[model samples]
Target: MKTVVAVYTGQGLADPLKKVFQELLPDVRLVNIIDDSLIGDVVKAGRIPPGVARRLVQYYRNGEELGADVILNTCSSVGEVADDAGKLIGIPIVKIDQAMAARAAASYERIAVLATLPSTLEPTMRLIEKEAAAAGRAVTLVNGLAAGAFEALNGGRPEEHDRLILETAERVAGEADAIVLAQGSMARMESKLAAATGKPVLSSPRLGVEQVREVLERLSREGEAAR
Candidate 1:
């Protein structure tokens, strides 16, 4: 079985992402490494601190040592770190939001990225911009922050969190060709936001898992060719 190591900075997306893996790559072995405090440290620093980045790199190396065929980074806030780590890591490192961002950038001229935290929102936006530049596509990005929603969710009021996200999506839908949820945790809102706004809503988990499947397939083919 192909082994995948998922590194998470928070617990919010763990179950959802695992479900995706179960559905999409059931034969693959899934291993998780979660450090919930990493998110707090990033938020406090307003960016990924050097120490935090080093720790994340260590986690990637640990995954490699565990014989991971691929490493999945599940935090948009530290996505750039994942990019850098990819250069040093032997196996593929997939940032959870990368495929979603690439799709949004390639398909939409006006994309709105919604997130509860500035830390996630900024990195997600930058990722889309980077993808767009690589594709030679000029895209306009709109930032939508569901202010207080993260706090509400952490406070055990999920309904309020959903409502706030919906409100933010509604407000930005008028100007955006598509909506992208900046965090994997917000994936549950994808279909609802698309239905409510009549727009394409992109989320990370499924797309990221699909990308992982693609990588595994490619690796399999290469292994066969070498034989």
Candidate 2:
């Protein structure tokens, strides 16, 4: 069976992707490479060291050796690194939120981004701004960061965490046409947040999975033709 590699900095991102993959790509095998130790405080602080990019490249190389048809990095903090890895390898490499960012810019002129970690919000905003410029659209980006939301999610109070997320998301409701959940983990509350705001909820993991599946399906088709 063909396989794809999905690298994550923490289990929070991987757990959701597993659910997504189960629903979307059950036939395709997935190799999960999770490194929780690297998470540390960098995610909340919103910083990525230069070395992180190199580490991502190494991960991609290993995935290539394992014959992965594609590689996906689930952390938005290392998005640029993920792109860099794509350039280093001929095979497909995907940044988790790229497609979500592009879609968010297209669907909504005013967008609210909800993130648990401060570091994720700014980079995500920059990504949305870049995508909006590429699409020739101007978008208003709003931030909805709830204090301790990340802790709540990781601390095993998902319902409470989602309540806070929905509350914050609702505050930006009238201000934006849609909401973008910056991290895949934040995707857990996407539907609830959308319900609270009565606007479309865009999540990185779902969109990213869809986009990567498109690429991989294309690759599969091309390979079949070549055979």
Candidate 3:
């Protein structure tokens, strides 16, 4: 059996993605390694500082050590590290937001990045910008911060968190060609955000899992070919 390990900085992300994996990647065993401090540390430092970056790489390495066929990094804030660590990990490393960013950049000219955390917003926007350039599209990005949504989600009031996200999303929608939810924790509100915004709402969970599946399948094909 192939084992897929997800390294997450927040349980809000890890738990929901776990559920998605259960439904979508049933045959593959899913494991989680979490470091809650990573998110808070990044937020405080306003960037992935050296220590945190080292830890991020180490976390992925540990996943590979545990016999991970694929490593999924579920936090958008530090998702960029996967771009750097993919080869070092010696397995497919799925950055949760890469597919979403590519889709957003290609689908919309005005991309609205909605996040509850400042740290997440910056990296997600940077990811979108890079994708936009790659696609040869000149894009404008608008940042939307849903105040208190993260707190509500963490405090065990997901409904309230969803409500806050919807309200802010409604306001951000008119200005955006499509809306991108910056954090994996906000993945659950895709439908609500779409209905509330009447535009394409992008979240990482679904697309991220699909990418994980794609990488694993591709590796399986190559292995078969080699044999």
Candidate 4:
């Protein structure tokens, strides 16, 4: 079985990503590297510190040593680090929100990036902008922060977390052609947000897993051709 190493900055998306992988690529082996403190450090620094980036690169190398066919970086806050790490890592490094950001950039002229943390928000918006620039598409991005939602979720008040996100989405929906949830942890809200806002709502986990599947398939095909 092809091995996928998922490096997470927090535990929020661990179960959800595993579930997505099970549904989308049942044959693949999924491994996780959770560092809950990473997100807190990033939030405190207001950006990814060099030491934090080095630590993440070390984790990616560890995944490589474990024989990962692909590495999934599951934090939008450190997504640019993932991009840089990809250059040094042997296997493909898939940023969890990359596919979602690409889709949003390509499909909508006005996109709103919704996130519970400022650290996640800026990187996600930058990613969408990067995607649009790469595709030569003109896009406008709006940022929406569901303030206190992360704390609520961490406090075990999921209902409050959802409520705050829903409110933020509703308020931003008027300005956006579609809304993109910046964190993989919010994947569960995709359908609900789409239904409530009557617009496309993109989330990372499923799309990221699908992208992993595609990469694995391509690698398999290349292996066969080499034979």
The TM-score values for the models, in the order shown, are 0.98, 0.91, 0.94, 0.97
Alpha carbon deviation, residue 86, candidate 2 (Å):
2.0
- Which candidate gets the maximum lDDT versus the true structure? 1
Write the candidate numbers in order of decreasing TM-score: 1, 4, 3, 2
Judging by TM-score against the true structure, name the best candidate. 1
Q: Using TM-score as the measure, name the better of candidate 1 and candidate 2.
A: 1
lDDT of 4 by residue, 1-227 (tens): 89999999988789988888889999999999999889989988989999899999999999999999999999999999999998999999999889999999999999999999999999999999999999999999988999999889889999999999999999999999999999988888889999999988999988998899999999999999999
Q: For candidate 3, lDDT tens digit of each residue in 114-150?
A: 9988889998999999999999999999979888887
Give Cα-based local distance difference scores for all models: 0.95, 0.82, 0.89, 0.93
| Candidate 2 lowest-lDDT run of ten | 37-46
Task: Tell how far residue 130 is off in model 3, in angstroms.
Answer: 1.0
lDDT of 3 at 109: 95
Q: Compose the digit string of candidate 1's lDDT tens values, residues 1-227.
A: 89999999999899999999999999999999999989989988988999889999999999999999999999999999999999999999999999999999999999999999999999999999999999999999998999999889989999999999999999999999999999999998889999999999999999999999999999999999999
Clashing pairs in 2: 46-119
lDDT of 2 by residue, 1-227 (tens): 66889988787777778888889888888998877755554664458766666676888888888889888889887786776666689688888899999998988899988887777788889999999999999999988777688788778998878777878888888888888888888776777777777899998888888988898889889999999
Q: Is candidate 1 or candidate 4 better by TM-score?
A: 1
The regions of model 2 sitting more than 4 angstroms off are 154-160, 224-227
Colliding residue pairs in candidate 1: none
